[model samples]
Target: MNQQLLSQVMASCVNAPDWLMKKRQLAVLLQERFKSTPAAEKIMAAWLANPSLAQLEQSVGEQTNADQVKAAGLHTTGWVNLPLFTAANAYPELLQENLMEKAISWQDSQLNAMHLALLNGGRFIYIPDGTIVKEPIELTVDCSLPNYHNLVIVGAGAQAAIVEHQTATGRQPAYFGTELLLGDGARVDYYQSNRFSAVQNHQAVRAYQAQHSVLNMYLALFDEHDLTTDFYANLDGQGGAAEIKMVTIASGQQVQDVQTQILNHGPHTVGNIVQNGVAKDKAVLNFHAVGKTERGAYGANSQQQSRILTLSDECKGEADPVLLIEENDVNAGHAASIGKVDADDLYYLESRGLSEHDAQVLLTRGFLLPVLNQFPDQKLREKLVDELAQRLEEKHE
Candidate 1:
């Protein structure tokens, strides 16, 4: 990274939160740790180089129409949250209230640090304590850029649901990072879904929950070429709970790597992770999950399950689930499996008149349907199913 480019990016971050400034400073020291620019960073740089909105649309591919956003009662933003934070928008009151002091830390790794240092602008969404937001807040990354770092703070007793996405664009690979801070008694339902054309799509999430809080996360991948998510949750307060679910479908040499870790820091904390995926063609899907009970978390309960079903003889699927228990009073377990579709179930579906290929598609869809069903929005659910169906059909063809 050149000094001039770094200075220019920093100049754009005027009035950035103090913590973010410190993080940027720390990033310089760790530059030697990471040798190359992350793939998502490259895409962001491309979008940044061409700032015209029209050209951006062409390069990154267009997102949902404005009409669809309005019909769904959603809020839309063209760039990442950075621009929103840099400029005073209509929601100044909300922005001022929820803007965290510092978003990223030196602990987030070299790639995340590089993203933070290079991000020109950022977006913020703050849910005040005790307030309930029924409608999901939608963020569309239609225009590629380096605005990957986002901060979401849910105050004590607050409740909200957020659906974030990067529409399938063949042009640029994208990277996104989010820090979710849930105050005591807060609750949040978070969903991240992606479909990109032969480009790497990456997201890193770090979350913390206070006492009696609840955090539910959903990851959905449809026809992704290369997908990677590093998700970590910290249950730091007693009675806190965290649940993560993921569903993915890969075909034609697509590669996916998903890692999730849950740490119980307080007694009586509960955590669960579950993922289901389908691989066809020469596609490969790999899952890694960890459930940990700390020494002082006497009553912590943790579990993880990772399952991948394969439809093609050439496909590859692997699931690795790990459990770490440091306290005797805590309960923890993990289950992992990779296998072909059930022969009996395939036969049963085939007996009903479906062709062999059709049977595989039907059963594959059924295997991953459970995770999608957990979404609260029926519209989103239907849309995801439609996309999944399209991806499945591609395999059949």
Candidate 2:
């Protein structure tokens, strides 16, 4: 971490917990002052150079209303990453141990020391055994920093949905990670929507499932100057299944990379990933989906599907979906494709008396819009639609 930049960011820190500082100190020691990995080095450089947070602070005069945040059934933190409100009064109680650590740490350590020291506090949602929460829980994060350690736990036989929205102005940098665990027979649906402009964003998701549980995730990344997301899951429970679906729209020098991996350790476990991306202007996008079924995990099933629709000749997109099966009894497969909007379709729509712009927009929508079905909530679906429209309206190549 850059010392001067760290001081500037820390200036906004509010009512931070005591344990937070203690963990941060330890993280500082483990901070690997010289990042050995190229990726870590690049991330650190971005954090140091980002000016989004300071610029946002100068533009927005007032903090968002706490009541509105809570009323919307959101567990949210302010720009400084301090817990500002929790909807349904699901506060400290629901935010169990930093399962970002594990089931019973009772304290924070250096494992995530760097982020602990950099972030305010994380969102924690723990679902009890056999408890079915029909209404989806929404979490709103109004952060400008680079670390958000969020966790979700679904007890045995329980079912729940979690929707997370990250909104910020400017193309600065936003980096965060989420962790989820599902006990035996549990079912969960996780969805995320990011609304950022011209940013260098890095996002990560880690999940573990117990026997006979099911986990479904839907994510929408509107656009950014540079964006990367990594998804990791482990099917540790027999008969457990995981599905990840994602949609992205990028334009104007944007770069996007989304990768996923599933470690199959339980017999009869299933994992699948599906993603659709739209590239305009000179943007670039890449997708890597990997499924590895360890030996003895018999009867495993894995699949992947990915496609990219490039709007301009200058844009680039690639998809690499791979599966490594160590068990002969398992079923695994993948499909990927990249193409441009059909000129014949556009011409036919134009000959029907529609404007050229309208024809292209309609075609683009037809190609990339169906992914919205992944969202379970109508309101969320509408919200994402609006955001997508704004991004698509930007200048195309």
Q: Which candidate is the best by lDDT?
A: 1
Q: Tell me, what's the RMSD of every candidate?
A: 6.6, 6.4
In angstroms, the error of model 2 at 193 is: 0.4
For candidate 1, write residues 342-385 as lDDT tens digits.
Answer: 88988998999999889988888789998789877788888888
Count clashing residue pairs per candidate: 5, 2
TM-score of each: 0.80, 0.78
lDDT of 2 by residue, 1-397 (tens): 4465445445534333334434444455555543343444465555545522221121212335545433343323211122321311234333424444542121332224444445533465667688787777777767655565566777899888888886644344555667788889999888888655535666777788899999888888875657777687889989999998888887788888888887888999999888888887788888888989999899999988999998778999998888888889999998999998788987899999998767766766776678776667788788877877776667754
Query: Candidate 2, residue 293: CA error in Å?
Result: 1.2
lDDT of 2: 0.68
TM-score of 2: 0.78
Q: Cα RMSD for candidate 2?
A: 6.4
Off by over 4 Å in 2: 1-23, 31-42, 48-98, 102-113, 169-172
* C-alpha positional error of residue 323 in candidate 2 after TM-score superposition, expressed in Å: 0.9
